[model samples]
Target: MVNERDPDAGTEHWLDLGPDPDLDSDPRHPGGWRWWSLLVAAMAVAALLLTQNQRATHPLPGTDPAGASVTRSASVAARPLPESHSPPRRTGSPLSGQSLSGMLFGASPAPTAVEPAGAQASAVSVTDLGHPLLAVPAGWELFGQGPGIVVRIELGRGRVTRTSVPEVGSASPIFFVVGHDRAIVHPMDSVPGYVVRDGKPATQLPPALDQAASALPGPDPWHLWAETETGTATALSLLTLDGRPAGVQVPIPKDATVQASDRAGNVLMFGIGGMYDLRQDGMHRITGGTLLAVGPTRWLTLECDESYRCDSVVIDRATGARQTVKASLDAYEQNAGAISPDGRTAALLQPNGIGASTVHLLDLSTGADRLTGVTTSSDQTLGGRTFVWSPDSRWLFVTNGAGRVLAIDRAGRAISLDVHVGAIDQLALRTTRR
Candidate 1:
């Protein structure tokens, strides 16, 4: 009886733990079923979204991965390279096959191959620097004089620029010593000298020397060599426009005078005794003759024999060696001449025992003489002197008493140049770039 009574009580307790049958239809229980359903749908949706996100971030096998595309873009960016900016070599020049960096930083231009002593020079084209324009090469200029003024002639671009010296007189005979971009002009008169640069105004050069003669550009481009006479003694002086001497002055003999000088710093001295080399230490006696011209390493002297015939001697400055060759010239009239720029030939004007004179070309290396067809009077002057050798030693520009300008080459052919103005008073060659 006791066991049967406990079974019903147990059933009641179990039913109480479950949902209330009557409360299921209540208003508060309305949202309870739908809330569980909505939770289950949201769980399914979250699972779908997570699957799509994983597929986007990482590809499946056998398909291209996102990282692979990224790698391909990186590879394409590294494909191209840039070009170099070096200069090309200059072929066939004296500076052949040289680079710009080598020339600018560490390398020097190769030395130009020189021809043999007796070898004939190749032909060169000649251009006259006459009046009106005074046309010249691009790097060449007439620094010595201007038209009625102390001026500088800038030649380039097929045009001529005559820069007048506004500070000096119109009639001044201006002589200049030029360097890289600088120039110093001495008026060769009582006026003081002046300094000028590429883009600057003219300024005075201090401590001018009186009666300076036989002036060459310089011991160097920046210095000047001049012969100034003080009382009885003629001094072989060296000075710069800035009042500084490159070296000490060398005193010449009392009666000795500077006859001829060259750009190579060799001075020819002639006095009652003979010729002397005015060195910085003292005077070195050279020869006994009238000094004619000075070359790079040789001095041309005219020594006469008993027959009144003069013989030209080429004296080596370093060895004191002499090569005496008879010059076929009228020794009484045209006794002076100049050596070729190459130091291989000598040109003299020989009179044919008449009033007419011929140009005698002597090859000093081979001692061979060739006569040119050019003829002028014995009294004629070439640029107020005898003759001028071209800087290349290839031709000679000659002037006659008729005021005709002729360019005679090695083949003895004379080419006449047009001279619209008067006779040429002075002539100079621009041998190097400024």
Candidate 2:
């Protein structure tokens, strides 16, 4: 009945209901006890844990948190805040009374700043290859005589190397006699004139009225001349090493002295006999005669006797201008002169009016240069003819025209033992001749 809800149209069935009270019944019920006992046990356990923690240890000084203590930890260690109190401004005139506090006690040492080993940075350095090792630097192994006709000893790494000079244009089968390394046969011009390398002829020009009284091998940039007869009065001549005809040939009156082809590709003809004019290259009536390499980029014209020998005239190759560039020696002649492969330096001959010879180098950079005595005389009959400049520039091999191949330094000092000329460690060059 209690489970039924009153309504004008009532419903009866109900389920899942709790007991409902009625006013007319009497009953007795028992209550569960001892609930407070569990609570008391919990409090006792917490108290024991607190006591153990406190008695365990009192951490030495700073080890314990600033104010983190058994009792006052919350008040002392809890983050301390900045005060709103402002400092008092300074006033002038004072009877300076700085009060001292009670007996100052011990204080903790300030932490060391530990000055940083200020970071050190690194640096760089590079050797400039200027003048051919012109003065042996240090640490160079001389393999052998460099490029030429017979076997030329090479001095360099891998495939890049330097060797001996092969006989280019000559009479007979003048070879690179292992003995005659520095000496070139007196007359390089052929009678029926043809350019020959090794024993073979490379090019041939008709015989001319006049052949160079003497010949000088080219500088680094080789300067060459050939005289071939076009007819009786006029002869065909060229300034280049290879071409069907010379780049240019101007008419000459039967005789001309010095002929030169500069790097600019211009042909020049001049004579230093007694009184002369530039017979070619349009440099008409220029004084002085024999042209010699005076600098890396300059040439020298020496005023000599009718034989055409004098102090060399140095001219700048770039502008084809003239300046007297003299070697320290009083008198000398060029059996051979070479501009260093480095192009920044050069090698030359300082001949003793007799047979001995010396070597020198012209430094293009500092304008400072030097000369060193390289050899005594070389007779192919006795020795041979050839002296090759080492590619490193540090040494020059007095290898040819002498019985022995000696190594001379840039300053003209003897560095290596003299090696007899041979094929042991040399490069072979075969000049083409027909």
Candidate 3:
């Protein structure tokens, strides 16, 4: 039977039943299914808006889905990761800008090449010699007089050590033969000498050499020849560094003073008698010229004219070969020159003017002379300044009257020491043994 139904009365109940045909066709009210779909769509829209709001409030550390930078909120503080979980920071050369992840993968560049052994050493210049040890007289004691003091200067460290000599009085001339670890101060007087070792307190030499009238260095550093006189008889007594007699005694001319000796035991002496050469066989007088400097196979002799003008000649002891040293305009005294250890060169100081001398190098082979461009000044009280060549003959060490020491190389490069001692009486270098 067709019955009249109120539309609003059963609207709420329509959710439980299927669509009514009359209501669906009447078009007066929308279908219940249509109304329910509208409600579902509204709820989904609300949920999506809530999710979008949350993402904008707190963004991630990286870029967003739109490929734009997303900054995090200041309200939400970040926490540091644990050390074990953190990435390593890049440092040092060749990898300063590299990342840990890049290094772990195969993205790193090739490493730099290492230098070869001695390649860095080869970069050092030829003039660079590590600081050398130099010694100078500490006091103004007369050269031939009483006890002498020595001041050792470590050129690199600026350290100074003073060593005093004892027992040998000032009546004789004091001489020094310095070595790497030891230094001997022997006075020409008839008294005991002193030996200084490694900067320690000097000890007296052996009593056996107490009677030595004069002493000269032997062919080696470990030995020396002492001239001893016993009741009008003069002899050369060989003694070791420790003062023990070498058991070799050769009678020499009376009043003869030993000048220089070579490694072959040949001795050169000069005195009131004349210049004499003491060989293993016997003594022979050297005439016509005065011996200046002696080496292993060669010797220098000086001949002066009536006006005291001198000429130097190098003589070969083996074959008597002679070569005249190239003449210089400046006057050169006999005492102002020395022979190199290799016997191939002679270092001479030619007086340039008052209180000044110019250093010249004379080639023993070709007799050629050249200026070293080094000028030394003296106070004139010391008579003249002396210089010594390094055992290798690569350098010459000289001192000025002002107490400044200079090291001049073969190339004319000069370096001054940074110390001032005030009036150096004597100078010596503690050089390596050749």
Candidate 4:
């Protein structure tokens, strides 16, 4: 029997057990089983205390058994790192360094070279002829020639057609394409002009143009202005392509010279004092400046001092509004410029002092000026080389004095034609016949 205390009853009770032989033999140690029981109770109490100490050191997550995140203490809050300071990485576009306007207008950054299918034999120095970037316009023919040969280029197809005109001889010829298969050809001297059809002289021009000193095309394609001088008197007579008189002869100032003409048949003349505008009604003197180029509505002129230092200005014909364009310091007497057909852009050639001219483009609307990354060894004189624009106003074709031509766009991208003639004195875009 085991003795247990019932505290509620305040009495002693006995736990009954069966007799055991081992309990009887262990007389030396009385109540030994009770001692074993006390030792086991001490071990159990130690284990419980150890478990509670571990829980206090490593507390449970802040969440109460649900997934909701509990608020942390202020000392344990998180913070963002500082912002980085680095330049942006560059892109791989060929036009990387170009202006937004250039890119928007189809200028490529990388240099592109396109060699026409049989162009190996006529290939000149690649250094002089820049790479080809864009395709030429369709149905356009570029005409020029060397001694005894007329060179015609079908730019759209990159085709070169040569016609042998023995009449050209060794002298420089002044020619203009009148029809797809015919042109008006004359020696630069006092020789009478003739019409050439398919590389052969077809017929002589009318007697009225026999003593014409010079011929200028346009105001329109169907009409021409023939300058004829008799003794000390000089007159400009308008004529049709077939050599018939279109208008009466208009007397010109002896000392004044024609600078440019527009599609509206208005002739701009410059003399010692100032500039004059000649229309069908009468002649009127306008602003005083050296005229550079003329568009449908605007005109470009240069005002220079005695030292030849000059400033460029764009004048509006209707409102007479003047807007000064930024020009290079090197733009002096030797510089030449032309405005686009749309009157939105202007190309200026500044002599580089080493027999080369650098091309510059100006935006008339915003007064933005930029380099075209193009240089030419052409003569910068008004009568030596030509700067002719495409009818669409998208491309500008210029001669390189060496008989080759370079085409440039408003975006400043340029392409050199793979052609070589002796000396290209004149360049004219083929116009449509009426």
Please give the lDDT score at residue 131 for candidate 1: 42
Candidate that scores best on TM-score: 4
lDDT by residue for model 4 over 64-110, one digit each (tens)?
Answer: 22334454211111111111111123443333466444444466655
Q: Which regions of candidate 1 fall more than 4 Å away from where they truly are?
A: 1-214, 228-234, 241-243, 304-310, 330-335, 349-360, 366-387, 397-406, 416-422
**lDDT score, candidate 3:** 0.56
- In the range 367-428, model 2's lDDT, one tens digit per residue, is 45676655545422111234445454555565434434566666656653423444322211
Q: Give the range of the ten consecutive residues with the poorest summed lDDT in model 4.
A: 119-128
Runs off by more than 4 Å, candidate 2:
1-225, 234-236, 239-253, 258-296, 301-313, 321-329, 334-346, 362-371, 376-400, 403-409, 413-419, 422-434
* lDDT (C-alpha) at residue 256 in model 1: 77
lDDT of 1 by residue, 1-434 (tens): 11233565564322235564445555757557756776776667566757766776688764444434332112111111111111122235333555444554468666543323321111111233534332334665433332222223343322222222333352534454555455555555565554555444344455543246545455555566676766777677787645465666777766775644443554656677777766667787776666555566666677777787677677886788888765533352332466776888766666677776777677776657777877765232211233566666777766554545566777667776454212332334444555
Off by over 4 Å in 3: 1-148, 152-160, 165-172, 179-181, 190-193, 260-267, 271-274, 279-287, 303-311, 328-330, 351-358, 371-385, 420-423, 428-434
Clashing pairs counted in every model = 0, 55, 4, 3
State the lDDT at 246 in candidate 1.
61
Give the candidates in order of TM-score, highest first: 4, 3, 1, 2
For candidate 1, what is the TM-score?
0.50
TM-score of 2: 0.39
Candidate 1, residue 149: lDDT: 22
Error of 4 at 396 (Å): 1.1
